[model samples]
Target: MSPLPGIVGALLVLGGCMVGLRLLQRRYHPHPELVRKLMHLCVGATALSFPLLFHDPQPVWWICGVAIAFMLALKYVSPLRALLGGVLDSVDRFSLGDVYFLAGVAVLFTVSGGGLTFTIPMLVLTFADALAALIGVGYGRLRYPAADGVKSLEGSVAFLTVAFVSAHVPLLLSGATGRAESLVIALLIGILVMLLEAISWQGLDNLFIPLGTFVVLNGHLDRPLELLLFHLAAAVTLTALVLLLRRRLGLEGSALLGAAFVAYLCLTLGGWPWLFAPAALLAGYALLAHRSRLPGDIHALVALTSPGLFWLLLAVYGRRPELYYPFTLSFAAQLACAAALALPADPDGRVRPGPLAARVGLAWALVFVPYAVLLGAGGLVPALHGLCVTAVAALLCLALRRARRLSFELQTTLAATASLFGLAPLGA
Candidate 1:
């Protein structure tokens, strides 16, 4: 089929699906999510046909653009709202899920040119997610916090089971991989995507799940079975370890899962030596949090670790060896700054600068010494450079500490900025 007819047909199918769902909703008045998931399944299933119907990506883009405009019209345009709003707007929570769904589908189709790589993510999104939601709403009893709302262990398990099937059946049917390799790949994708969904806020899951699935699948598609098994083991082991320390860490369930995802990314992409700083920070913070009852959540974790995550990406993805030290130092500075704040305050609830400075020095030494040793082993010596950077971070953190209102944010920013020290020509 040519692009024009394909675009028209695609739009017609999407419109028909929406209008059909609206009629069912008006007549039957089923649960909003049931109707929503029905729409999700229909649209996703229709999307699977794009690889065949249109040979080029232009038509897919056109279809997605039109659909997004129509979806927005349903939300805001009064006439369209009266006609089409019943199906989508029935839910109470705020969501741009429909919009994100269209966008993700378009991007995935374009990038993978619509093949097995595209098929699995779409299936996971279309089937696994829809089933998980319906099952979660009906049968889920063991609940915990997720993004803006709560999710059930039952729901997550459902998602994992369906995602595994979605990933496995395709690989097995295509005969692209052996059974053992297929099994390992499916398990890894299931665990990772489930965690992605668990931590997604708003309608971003529609965006993240497919893209994340593509990354995991494409990155490991050709690896040996041994590496695949190792990856699978690492994901499971990290998840288990985090859950075991959930209480001591003082992070919510979703936050803990987020931590596991970040840790896995670091370990797999950056290697064992790269894992030290974050692990040390987490361990020390977990100890202090348990002692002082300090609570940290997903938002806090993002704030503190985003910079280090950036540096890690640069070192690995951009092939910049110099940035590795910056990546490691960012975490060290983060730990040092955090530790300084954990000091015992005076009876009046004020922290003296002398004790604060002493605390910062002690904390930096504790975190950096081990990390520096690892860097030396890895053939990068930034020891003196790291010390100077950390001292500057501690001083800036001390200066920002008196701000009282924005202390944590200020200190975190300062610590991240210390990464500049690592940018100084490596050997110099």
Candidate 2:
């Protein structure tokens, strides 16, 4: 009665087909090397599926743990040769989709309480990746690469189609009907997943794809009008800021100012707790703007900002369903500001500080400060604390410009001290 048996059986059948194909390629087709490689891939996939079939504790653990150990061993040993024959490249050379597949299975086991709706979207990534590769290699012609010339439009379309269809499977199984709704949801999810894959360079989409699918599927988007307006306003403001900065100030100054503006907006919006990201943006500008430095300072700023800010925004507004739109708007505004400041501009532009600073300050005012006021008056003292915290952060940043090697201990102390004052006694 358990779906686990059926799932495992499906995986095994797929793997067996792959193995059979490899055998045919080796015996009749005479492509021994390709056959060996395919065989290894099939073996790995089949071994991974074993846990899905037998849902006992030991078998599941052995399937996962042993499979991982086997992969690791293959990285050192010639796994392809061991499985079939002939030396093959390291497993690292292959996309780590197997890991994602395993992770999805783990997620399914852990969150089975949420029903099939929860586990269904994850399959989209697996199906999409394989389907895209298959289609692209066979029929790809139209290419579209963001930076490197490795991506193609054919691949994108294939990925989107497969992911979209795969995303609908669980929904259909769970009783979602009406051909129109299913098609629309599938299309939306597919597009989003493809987009994430296209932009992701560091293979982060393995995690982001499934997670994003889950959010979009479960989360409500009731304020489309507000979201659209907020995005438009943010985009316009960012464009104006970039154009003004480029015309009035040199690229370097604009970069610094733009980074600062974005940082301020993020802090004000309550997304990030510190100003370090903005500072890093500034430092990046400093390096690119100056010919003398390697921009080691950017790392320092990133290190300071990442931890404190990473969870701040999500913690503050993630649960407040009503405030989601406003928070999304503020977050979008910050990103827009950052992108605007990062645009490439002509070198002949003059550097003017006055207008640029004012624009940055204006953005902070329109987006973050007003939101803070709304949150503060609503008895959210943390908003007030956030402002005080950011002010101290600003001062610390000014200090860091003079001394980059400020110790981690000192930084922690400073952050703690600022936090204490920021959260000063309510009456005080």
Candidate 3:
């Protein structure tokens, strides 16, 4: 068989398999909405795979245009009304598949060179997105809402696992890297993609998953140490801002501020080192504040800002050696001050302790100390860093159980944060 025939055969097989899957879904599930989603996936996968087989962009464009026209016509026609209803409902129902498909296409187009550089990322997105949804929907008990309140833990795990496995397949098949190296790359990509998915709202994963995969595959970290320091700075700064704002603005506003800060940091400094900090803090605070309604909103502030304290310390001392000693002493002093403020002793007292406050403080401390230590150790033993984070997060969840009321906000936050830690090592 000629090379051309082989390529065509592969495409045919893939297309056939997808179509078969759609038929099965239609027959077994009989859910019009799900069937419509599968159809969209079919159309997209067909268009994308067309380019690879023909090696001509025109055929792919033509196919997409035709498909789009067909969809548009179906939108108006009465005979196709049943299909349209399904399509409309499916579109309304949020899933990450479209985003993954788009990302795969982007990676295919942007990476110039053939081979696995482009293909691996696309495969990762496809596999991860599909698997995450499958797992989350089928077996996921722990659900957390994304900014859009639509995402869940089951979906995230499916995404992470699929992405990892997808990336691993290409690495193994290409024979370009060792098992250990392939494992590391898979872990890194999986963790990074999962992080992006967790924080995304309202189908924004469409933008993030592709961008994140591109960044990781590109290996854009020229100065690992400096970039890491910048991430720490941004994380800390955002954490502080979230803490300060949660009381004044409330949950949505606090989250918005934190997100804006992260965007600014990524734009100026590059990467999202601070992504988890604000997410954890604001969510946790919102949970506690809603349940307890403690006065002065100090508990909310503490919960929101606690994650930052660790990032600040790591940035000043761990990331930047020049500022280490002075910053270390200053951080020690600050902790003492915070402790003193929370204590029952000041005569012209401003700070007052609440039941939730102490637990939040402890939880914050537990997460922070291990994160800092793991991050510090990451420079030498990357795997160990991942392990430390996982361990600490598990312990944090156990610790949170002691608190009287786990607000939806805090429960979601803790679950998401724990998910972050749980995912980190898999990608690493």
For TM-score, the strongest prediction is: 1
Best by lDDT: 1
Q: For model 3, how does the per-residue alpha-carbon lDDT over 1-428 read when each residue is reduced to its tens digit?
A: 23456345544554465457545755686545345445444544444454456554434334434443444454557666454434433445555444344444544554434446656655655446545655665577876534545456667667878887877777778876666666666665675667666665555565566567666655522335454344445444654565466553344422433344443333333223333334433343344334332223223433434344434444544664322222222222222222222234234433344632454354344334434553575423433343344334433433444344434246335433433343233352
Name model 2 segments beyond 4 Å from true: 1-61, 78-95, 113-115, 135-150, 177-181, 199-204, 211-360, 376-428
Give per-residue CA lDDT, model 2, range 1-428, as digits (tens).
Answer: 56555545654564455557646755677433344345434533453444445454344444445444544554456655466322222222344434444454445434433344444454665557655655665677875433212456687788888787776765666665445455556655675556556544324455556666665555312324343344334433543554354422233221322333345335445533233334333333333323322123223333334433443465455643233222323232332233223333235332234443443344334334544554465534444444434444434533543355445445434543443342242332
Clashing residue pairs, candidate 1?
none
Model 1 CA deviation exceeding 4 Å by range? 289-295, 347-358, 377-381, 425-428
List per-prediction Cα lDDT, in the order shown: 0.82, 0.45, 0.46
lDDT of 3 at 10: 42
- Clashes (N, CA, C under 3 Å) per candidate: 0, 5, 9
Compute the lDDT of residue 257 as modeled in candidate 2. Answer: 26
- How well does each candidate superpose onto the true structure, as a TM-score? 0.94, 0.53, 0.48
User: Candidate 2 or 3, higher lDDT?
Assistant: 3
Q: What is the lDDT of residue 236 in candidate 1?
A: 96
